[model samples]
Target: MTPTSIRPFPRWDDARAATLDEPGLLLYRSNLLGSDLRITNYGGGNTSAKIRQTDPLSGETVEVLWVKGSGGDVGSMKLDGFSTLYMDKLRDLKKLYRGLAHEDEMVGYLPHCTFNLNSRAASIDTPLHSSLPYAHVDHMHPDAVIAIAAMAHSEAITRQVFEGTVGWLPWLRPGYELGQRLAEYDAAHPGLRGIVLAGHGLFSWGDTAKSCYENTVDLIERAQGWLAQQREAKKVAVFGGPAVQALPEPERDATLARLLPVLRGLSNEGAPKLLHLNTSAEVMEFVNSADLAPLAALGTSCPDHFLRTKIRPLIVPEAVYTLAGAELRAALGGLLAAYRADYAAYYERCKRANSPALRDPNPVVILLPRIGMVTIAKDKATARIAGEFYVNAINVMREANAVDRYVGLPEQEAFDIEYWLLEEAKLQRMPKPKPLVGKVALITGGAGGIGQAIARRFLSEGACVVLADIDAEALQGVEAELAKAHGKDHVRGAVCNVTDEASVIAAFDRAALEFGGVDILVSNAGIASAAPIDETSLALWNKNQSILATGYFLVGREAFKVMKAQGSGGSIVMIASKNGMVASAQASAYCAAKAAEIQLSRSFALEGAPLGIRSNVVNPDAVIRGSKIWTGQWSAERAAANKVDEGDLEAFYRERSMLKRSVFPEDIAEATYFFAAEHLSAKSTGNILNVDAGNLAAFTR
Candidate 1:
């Protein structure tokens, strides 16, 4: 190894360590370990330490294990994120451990034995940590470590590295039994520095936090070094050759435009959610090669991936890439059907004693040969996580390819971990999410006040959003801001002229490609042009009708086509104006065009019903004076027509209504939210929600 080999391992700098007491040090170490994305991902790993604390009731000093609490990311963990457990009692769990069936009950019992008996929720691996005799213990699922531990010769590799100083535990479903086995293995090897859990992860320990952390870094570094040697030894006769076959046209992004919605329709899992299309050069090379295709059929890199990516990935054949239209759809459908049938057969063959509920059979990662990788999940975050696992699995497999044969855990073992109740309990403990958690929403005029408010509201309700507008600069600003808050996958902005047929189609296509498909469509793009009948020009009438009325038809028709293709019911919330239902003087062009827009929405609702689509309207009158739609000339025109100051438009509407409350954009946004919610309006399509501050004339039965 040279002096400049990029280190491959984290080096210690004691001066930078936090000046903290034992408890604070535990938190400090957690933050340090978790901060490195290579050491630990978002919430994949955990850490713990042993400290002495007074047992208040008994008035005796007792050893306590401070383990990371469940549901908290290690990088951001605090003192509260660690559960204070009595070490002796936690170790007793290993004595009571019988088999995998009691693992959930055993984990449940850990919280009751805590120092306060009301401490933070304990990490599921508390017993595993408690069983070891070390003062500090650290566990993480580092990418490089997993590559070595997930191999067929994991035991041999461990024996070779530490020469019996480190122990190897075979694939055991993580719970009480695994914890018990760890203790037994540690006891047998008295000089153990750490242990690698095969097909799971790694654990390191020492008398001090620094030592334990360094031990982990050093151990992983050595494992990485071993793999690197194997890599250097690998030789290829030929890596490049003549074109294998004609490459797919228009590139992977264009192919995804055709495939994502169809692939999303194939799933019976959650709603149409996010798709992570990885078209990186590394990924593209693997998918195109005949050699790497068979490697994907094997099980996951580690059992942990089973929770997200499932046991195996589905590789859509190369032929479908060249096909198009009905023929392509049919071919893809046949491929999905075959994959499902095979999964059913696998489930039947490996199902446990008592019939266990099968997991969602839909493959999370779908490799489109010569195109790239497509990962799907219930939400944007999970899709990214699942994608990470698949990518890591592929990397590990590639490494195993260079070192030795890549071996996956057995099918029954996969089922054991897949159906583990303790694992499911962690998911159950998470709080219930907002109503539209898995749905996708597209909002028109999204950079405008009413449109931005509607987009933000839907995002808050857990709907992944796509913001559309004609103003490219404003659209980019809103997209960057929202993406920062909700993640880049959750919110996006597209420049769209709603009146144009091709642009409208492209916007929906972007939604289908960005997210898997569109679940909710908010047609909110329109303008307010105020003029007397004699003053209104033919051009004015044409422009107002084109956007206010025709825009809805164009965007609505595209959403319908996409929704119909998805084979799932969807919702469309049209932002019509109160002027549509109630006439206003000097606003002839605006009122006439809005009236046509509202009726168009009703017509869409009536026709949409048979297709399981819901079309609803929210008729909003004058918004707050400074709202986006009324910012410039539009605000001045409305103020002049109403004979009131621009700032008084809000007050004017408030005083005109029965409720006497200002009809801000938020009020209209609230109405749009209500109409989009399936629980609130599932049985009531063709509905018009009046948001004009309780104006009776605008209210519809």
Candidate 2:
């Protein structure tokens, strides 16, 4: 494919570029290059510009190398995300370098070279950028380029593809030594546009930011074009053709729904992990291919890929797919045990004296033939990004295998990079995990005000939520709003009528597919009705019971099913009403239904205790503001019953409470969050907390 066909055209706007200083131009160039995954995966590359700036301490002009800071993604970074180091200081560090063994000490000297006292830590790639003899430099992991770089004869392929315009360097882990080697090569061979780092990525440089960006894109496109040509000429099947055809869409989804929870449960021996499933055509092709096992065993070629996806994915054997129910689960448990044991052996084989204690041994990526790929991590974003990295790896493997034998980084070399002291320090520096991190919640009536509030609250604490609502329009709007605030990966929406058993089950399945499984169930879907017994029709009575009582039962039953399968225990928080414990006038049906919800909670608590599942209730009364139930006839009916105008209902409820406070959705959300949080309520199940602003009559006695 040509650049126009396979790669994105340069998005540089001259007008935009003209309005920025050198540092701004560098940022603009980095964003442009990082925006396209075809150019590089998220946080997989680094960019830099050597700019002249006033030295803050000396009040004199000096050249500073501004490079993407540690753990920052160039695609979504700001000016502050770049670390500024004095060029002279960086160059002077060459005197202290004591070869590869002491290369790590070089990182300690970096802060001493800070140009502007910038707090953003410089990445290991700083040397790679600072050593290059160019005003601007970009190092990227484009699949098309990595394909050529990961080949057995990568140097020969690089020479053939670029016709000597681009140079090639053999596999050397990124650090001071590699940077020195790069400088040596560039000095030895002047005028070369770029160098493909074998079994890694590509590095390109130019006199200006625009030139550097174009050079990088152009080189990647050229490699893409060559690979496309080679693939067309070969006319061979990918991964030696599909070993097994993919199941139909419905069957595939069912298979994933069945497998994900079990995998998630098995993988959560340490910190619980969220799961992300990828059923894209590319993923399907690779997983179903005959070469899947052998190629996967070779592991990933790029360090960025392996860091996120782990060295290699666990390939589920064909026999496991033939079993069903308990037999299938037992089979999977055995496989996971073996995988963990193997990972332990790998650590034993490669660990050094000072290496960080063995990390999580469970596989991050799992490939199942006919079912696509599932990635597990501490959060939805990490899991999804891990899957994306694996996809990039798959692309590299596919293209390389089509032309020449693909080569993964040697195990010892991969181990050194994985267990590097600097990398371990970075991990140790990460912020503490949130309270609800790795927990998945399925919320019923999630489009409503209280539900949305609960969703937001849960999200803020780092839980993935699946919102289920019968109102499709409201559901979509709430989903978009929450996803915008807390990332698309952390929230999903399913239109579910809670009263319908199938809808309830589908909602749980959706949770399993979107995340791993349900760790918390918030049974908040409800309605309210007001009428004297004689005036209350059977239909009206049944409607209240159906939504309030049956809905809670259905959703709770499904949550219990998933939780039992996981064997990890879970929390169930029912949003009952104060009326459940207190009789109310002219609202017998509503009151009775709510009372049923309270009773069901106790029963669930009793039944779930042995399984490590806890059931609790949050009883919220007169929650008028931002409530969907109040927007209907229920508000006017209650106003009439209280002898107050519709607008005065809130004030009436407030004054009626002993605390003179009207409850809001957020208040109810707080109560629900308390019940759902294991750290707070793990030992307090079979209890009810009322959020009624001091309603004595409704108090649980």
Candidate 3:
């Protein structure tokens, strides 16, 4: 039988690859190969190359397997992302291995075989790549390929598509055993182009990286073509009855508004989950399918997807729309309880065969019929990836049904890999855990210098940040800057005047709409005014008070309202100034309004105490950078009132401080973070954190 080589080899010239070095070329190849989201969704696939390297100390040649490292995306992988494993040592582990009883134990087994002391943790599938008799190997979970591979009689379809050019291996939990099976299959099947793992993914190899990648694209394109043909010829059968409790068009967002908050709550597992609503046509089709219940209950198409998408999704039938308020909350709680209970039962059923402690019982993917699919995770990046994998799984299931009944690995098989050392290691070996992984922060003066710095700090710590300012252009610029560092979805900009009640409400509403809820508020918007008490006019005084004090009240009020309704206690950081704590000469309006802002914050702290809401004031003195408060006429007035030159103002404030250090916007940001930290300041509220470089006159006077 002729082999189905669908596409020609990919052109990987030096110009296209961007590098000529062995490792850099491999990274370039992996990136290009994994760039296609439909073929290899970000961070899910791997590539490896075999090369000879000389040990600097011993000066002996060694075979090295440079596989994609753990926790790194192939599309953006670099030299560091490829863990260098000594191939001879990895191959020799098979002889000493007493066989792994549980999957997690392989973590210990793997590091013990690494050749370099400072090497990153190798990809857990190093052995699988090492066993293949080729210089290069590319492995990917293409949706179209999985569609065909996950169907019942997938082996028969495999023969039909490739004409017996590729070998079909039934579900084997990946490890030493799977590695040995691949080696055995390679020996038996001569002239094999690739091997299709039933209910898993594909592995293709060649003498060069280009050939290996080309072969992968070839086989996947053929599988996609075959699945398309099958889908066109097949007729779908719909169930006779209509869906129960159908929701009207107007009620969909309303339902999401009500239910998403509950779904984004903290589980007993200590995991902070955020939700993404998926409303694509493909998702809706699967959500409304007649076999939605049974098909979804059949587990994921591959165990590799187990971490992103749990064993099974939480398929919320349309009938859930019938429940409301307390009744709705109770019903949702009951659904969670049922899911947890079923997961516990599944653990018990599978534990007899595989022993690893159980992970959180909450499902990652929640199907909401016509409403949309919801993906829950601890951060935006993870949630987005999880959601993408589910959509891929949905397409696979649909395509699988086109040819035959969609099927996946047996429950026990999926359980073994999901709990295995390699799979568990992929998640457990995280980067330095950010303090605000799932938290949402809103800054009122976000388009300004100090406010944007605070937003950047929170964003770096993994918080979704909303920037609200009257300057729409600056807001857009700041948002763009933040989005470059964090993802575009994690940073949002809204034009809001804290002096306007409606604007404040709209700002907080944007936060809830962008990220399901708000967890922190930095009320930092204000203007500075300087004048003798007699010269301070009503209009001047009112403008200063409106922005400096009333603005804080308006924004803080809206933020607290949302925080209270979320029932998930949050923090409110008021950006008051030193003028509030100490009397300033010729600055009656500024001093009075700032003092009022601090008092308002103290009042808010009292109201929020019973609800676990924390309110604190960060009183910073003349944080001049990016601060327009001291520019133009205000600068002259301030200098005259203080009897100092404009240039001397910086030194005057810094030298006057107990520490003689300049107070920066970042310094103020640090103080806000301190108060925002629940673990650090859980019992402390209505407190003033002075970020004034130790201003004795205004140090919490």
Candidate 4:
């Protein structure tokens, strides 16, 4: 088999390319590299071009590598695809890497002195790209060459195959070690065109872009020929008889359905496409062979790939796929039970005497009954990549074992790389701050002071807020105020009674329809009762509990259901009064209702945390002006009956707090914003924050 010819970019003249800015040139060059070299099919690699520009005042030239930007596919990168960095600043990272344990903070803390601040993340391996002395560097997993790397005598064979064209590496996990080793090898063997990593992929470089691209093609073509020859010469036996059995269409789909989620879970992404599978008798026979067990512990081709291709495959015997869903379920039950037990044994073996246990025991890849290998990636791209890599590794491991014992990275080293600082850095970059941004929030009783305040806060912080209230006029009035303060689109108004379940649910449904979904929930609606226990009527007791307690329950239940269904974590802020914590005279129903809301919030918090949702109770003290309880919207006679006067209310509320000041909704709003921000709250779950202007005295007033 002949390899694809490496194409030269006759059209891309560097003088013309350099006419663009550093970023523009970088994107163009990266795209050109991907296009010229067949290695990076479907955006499989990253490229960087380092340039030194003189500082006018100092008369000193500084080196900066314009790396590919995140989220920009190398295949279609543009001028914006690149981010410039001070090479001197980045090269300094080598020193920090040796002494510092947390590399991200050390690296991330370096501000963009020359580029836009809002630029997407620096390429994950910017240091490697920067550390290299080469003007042009390209990293890719060329499929043909990767196939060769999997061979047992791949290093010696590739040496004979490439004949001084590329350097060889024993596959260590990528990142720090790969970069360090490459640098060291390059120092020993200067001017090497590319590197051939065992059980992994290839890397190529040159003084010029064209040279690097051509060298890469040359190396891959040689490796490809070698692989084709080996495949042709090798005779593989099928364990089963000559005939292959195929699964029926319905059964196949049903089997796929069960496997898809497990695959997706392994891939750490949404469902990925199942490309063509090899289900021949020979393939099935190879899968069921005893050779698989020993190599199963070796993880994915790459650690990051695990989020795509999980560790190990589900090995199935030949007869399994012919069954119905129930039969498949039973088969899966038995298979998974054994798999988990094996995983536990593996986990225990892997664990040092005392360490945290593994979270997921299921294999990322699944070997189906008479179905070839299926990779679970978050998406099709990842799944295919994972599948290809796994298939390549298996082939290589076979060849290596045939020659001698095939050794892989130590389990501890694999674990370290899997949980490496670099991997953690990727996770930390976007920890889902402001997850509720651009989502709708509906707060009932939003016309009154506390409700109005909460509504306004949500609006100010980017949520499209609907302030629902029983009073039509008050709702319209508050809506107008919010519209005047926040833009018209930020606030919506609906007149609904908390006591009416139909009206409340209808309001929420309307908000969901208008705003796509409810991401943040602020359940702040409540009624107050002020009467001694002896004088408190059944009507009064029922009314307070109905709105303050039961209403919150109903709204909360709906919100939880909606959020959990959405699958993206949601946040619920239940505004329980400090009254729930401390007793006050003549307010039995209100106090009891508030206490119940607090407990409900706690339960929701515990349940939701696992699902990435959060429920927090905000104990707001003295957000009293226009409060339904204080404003007598329910009953003015009740306010007078409670002996709460209007004029001195602010002072009276302030006197109760340790700060001697009333807590405002704005303060609560800031706290809300913090929780919603992407970078704050490292592990804030089932937590209650008090927003009462230093009010520890819940009973003093």
Candidate 5:
């Protein structure tokens, strides 16, 4: 193996290091390493520095181990993310360590070693860092090093690659025992800089923070270079070369648009899961490879990888490429059943007396030969991260198989990690799911005030949203604003002319691709016009019907298709107007269109009831503020009809109401939210909620 051209270079600056204290330097090093995915995955590594600090209680200086805390991502973490423990107390923990069987108990003892009352919980990798002899330490799950570490001849390969600069240790579940073994190995090999933990990760150290960061990078670079050389020298085809060609981008996306909803539907049996699709060059190559099934069957080598992606992914059959509609769904259903059964059997085979109960049996990842990989999880970020972890696993396998046969962690070992009591406890401590968590909503007039308000409300409750509006510029701005306020993963924008069937379908497809499928549909796209029945032209009537009535129908119809395919109950909220149920003067076209919307919603409710789909209407009158309709000529038109100044229209509407109160987008949003939230109004369908400041004529009675 020879060095490759592309390698991670040290980014340490003496000036930067000089300004930062020892702890800050440690953070700097961790951030630098974590900034590159090629170095370490998100929350998949730990770093520490034994810094001299003045004890908060005692005035004396002491050594404190500042390490990446449990469940924190180094790249985005602040100073508070590090757990500080007394070095002397950590060393003293060896006395409490009875054996490997009781190693998990050591975690409880970590708080006792906490210095200065720092409450950040120490990670399981704490022992590995504290046990190292060096002042600075890093434990990283870099794909390159893990490639060597996961090889059948890992130890020999480590020796050959590093020429004794790096050492090797056989696979051990990370705990007190592994830490002790590391310390022993360091003592035996006086000059080694790091040790590659077989089937796990790499542990590197240095006398200084900079050196430790550099050493970690150097080792990973060396492994990457060696693998690159080996691949070149051996000239072995990756994943036994491509067995099938990838579909063209358009066709592939179309296939994904069709398949994702069905997959999401199947996965929603228990808790709903969001799906993420990856079609990067690497993913495309791997999924199209001849050895995809066999390599994927071997599972992931690193515990961090499988913990998110599961032990293995479900590979779609070749017939999937040829099937459509019911045939496609049936084939996928059968595949899912087999995958779940196999997972259940594996759980049974691996369960210990005290093991955690079986988890969701559905695979987190699904691979299609000519398309790409789809990862499903509770939310978008987790699903995306799961896909990334699998991609890293692919890289490891590609390189490892080039040099030597790759091996996954043993099945029993993988199960032990997956069902570990500590991991289970950590999960149990996570915050409860929000009311709308894992639900996806598509808003037809998402750029409008009502749509934006509803989106913000839904996002606050943890639902992913696809904002579809005919106004592309407004849609983009709203998408950006919402994404910034919520998160980029939770909001997406689609420029959709809801009146066009293809555009409406495309918007729903966007929703399916962005989230998994639509659980809630808000048909809010509308237009306002004021014309006497004698003066109303056919064009005005058609325009009003096209946007308000016809548009709602198209969007609602698409939503039903997706929801039905998902086999999950859905909620449809139509943003009709108070005029829908009342005769408004000189607004024949607008009132008629809104009336059509109300009737259409009731029809939908009747048809969808048996399928557990709910349809309801929110009637808001005189929403002059933040309304797109009011921003145009409709305001003057309404004011003229009411015989009031344009500026006094709001006051006029307020005075005209029975309650003399005004309506706003937020009020309408609240009403819509009630209908969409199943826990709030699961049994109340086909109902009309009036947010009209107490209008007598618009009353349902």
Candidate 6:
């Protein structure tokens, strides 16, 4: 047996270490550190700590994982090399899988571990660590471990040695499966604090990094003993290899120093200092392996480990660092290209399968074949932590190799974990949009204020919006502007009479033919008759009913026919006025028609719910500048007719709402956009959104 000396790990001053007290900085450092570990040519490992606290009032115990980050190694670890996560929260997530049919509901929205809002992303092994019931968790893949795990009989051999001892998982890929499998196995065993993955590496945890590191060393010794026994029987070659070129400590130290502050900024409030550094021949040999093919396929030791160390390791060779600057630049370019392409493909397939998308795909860790594993970090502290994980993984794999091959999770499962909703929700929570993309929307009187706004917003959010109005000139104007902005293919204009079924049907048919489907119906064509009830004539009533009320019904019927036949749920937006809520003087017929439109929206909501169709209404008030109805207010004759002063007209409408301000067309547009975006209004069937500024009187009965 050979006696190998451990390298000295870097450290930070107390003041700098204090920076890691901050959860945000801790996560940043941990992520970079972990990434550096896996990516460093000679590095591939990660670090984590559990923060346990008793609630001041409830006295309930709370635990969180302050894990080292991804994208860096451990050699230059800093306080920032940690991500804080709620342990209890992660435990609760494990409970969901036990429930009945909660899969769909929990799909992308479910919590991975405890959700951490301040981290770049939760550690891939978050579940594994959280499930441990420990305060600290650290993982790594030492060169010794990698050598053994990568062997053909690794799995069978691993089983023979560690049977029923440390949990063994066949390679399942990385990310979700690694976390889930280890967690599941640990839960089943209840007492196991470590996992040996066949053809992979190892997982060790403790109350602190030191404890975990010690346990790691113990595991390494066991594997070394087993290997020594095998060698004695077979006279196997001993590891008396020639020294290889390594990353010069002076240069490495300087590079690491430059990275420390960034690590501090990511992990804690204070800077961090390194300690117990370990650079060995085993580490260098493993880093400079002749065949990196299998290493390239090996995923991170565990899922949550990805939060600390990314999916793949960074491979570095001897001359690789000689041209370090140039090589890194070239590698980054290649990685970016591969990443973007892979990500795009993954996103497209996931979208097709209704799956979530991952944040990024670049390998956080670089595994240079030689020159020692250089743990790159946003800062030095993180780089050190990453390097530590690399060492750990290497050690574990060496021991586990005597038993079995380290197996990872499957790719599909990995994607599921990468796109896990629970993790994503922590970043940003937004509602799903209405199901209407690539769907054509034909708005009657779309050139008017509300209609035009709806059209513009829909088009902006990936819908084919058609502006239809009785005023040909106005429709053309909107068409021209939208075409100029979004292109002619996206915005269309047509002249149609809502009162005539043939005209209404033809417009819908044209829209469908052009856009391949008519999924959204915006019924907003109407004439306002503000004459007093006593002065309201039968002719006026007929005109208003025919255009506003009957017109809406005709459009809705046509849209329904198109959407139902297409076998896709559709959406309809009815622009009802605030005037319809409470009565207004001299608006009897107009009020009756508007009231009917509002009810129509409610009915659509109910009927459409069963068919995946959503019906909603936007109640907007005081947005008249762009509305045809308000154009008359600015006319010379209108001023004379109303007997109001010119300057007072603008103020008059502005004072109508509680906000005492005129609503812009853009405001109404934004509201309409919500109705069309699947994220904002996915579950809003029969919903009515008020675009008016705080109209208590208008909102409620």
Candidate 5 per-residue C-alpha lDDT over 201-311 given as tens digits, one digit per residue, 9 for 90 to 100: 999999998888888887888888888888888999999998999888878777777888888998875777899988889999999998999999999989999999999
State the lDDT of candidate 1 residue by residue for 1-701, as single tens digits: 31245355555557666567888877778888887766766676778889988898898999988888877778877788888888888766666766766676787688767896645887677777887788999888876677778778889987886667778988777667777788788988888888888877888898888888788877777777766766667753111221244345457656777777777776746545567777666566567665655677777757657667888888887778777667777888888788888888888887767545676677788887767778888787888778777776766766666676677878888876676666666667788878888788899999988988888888888999989999999999999998887777789888999999989988887887778788899999988777889999999999998998889899998888777667678899999888989898888888988888788888888888897899998988778643676765877787888899987777877898898887778888899989888877888788788887787877675
Residue 382's C-alpha lDDT in candidate 5? 93
Instruction: Report residue 225 deviation for candidate 5 (angstroms).
Output: 1.0
Question: What shift in Å separates residue 426 of candidate 5 from its native position after superposition?
Answer: 0.6
> Evaluated with lDDT, which candidate comes out highest?
2
Which pairs of residues collide in model 5? none
TM-score, model 1 to reference: 0.92
Q: In what order do the candidates fall by TM-score, top score first?
A: 2, 5, 1, 3, 4, 6
lDDT of each: 0.78, 0.92, 0.79, 0.62, 0.91, 0.58
User: Model 2, which residues run further than 4 Å from truth?
Assistant: 1-7
Q: Which clashing pairs does model 4 show?
A: 24-79, 150-396, 152-400, 267-307, 267-308, 269-378, 314-367, 433-678, 434-676
Please provide, for model 4 over 1-701, each residue's C-alpha lDDT reduced to its tens digit, 9 standing for 90 to 100.
Answer: 35344332325566766577655655665676566433554445788888777755467887767776654568777666677777776666666565323544545544543433436567556656766678888777665665556555678866777777678988765554457778888788876777877756777777766565556666666665665555446543322223344566555544553443222222222221222244444345446555555465554443333434455567765555545344644665677678778867766666644344464565556665435666532223344555555554554455444333445545565555545555555656754533334455777678877777666666655566778788899889889988888766557787777777777766765554333345567787776767778888888888878987888888877777656544556677788877788766677877888888888888888998887778877777767655566656424444354457656667766875688877776676666655544346536756677777775555423
TM-score of each: 0.92, 0.98, 0.90, 0.51, 0.98, 0.39
lDDT comparing candidate 6 with the true structure: 0.58
Candidate 3 colliding pairs: 103-420, 103-421, 104-421
Q: CA shift at 38, candidate 5, in angstroms?
A: 1.1
Off by over 4 Å in 5: 1-10
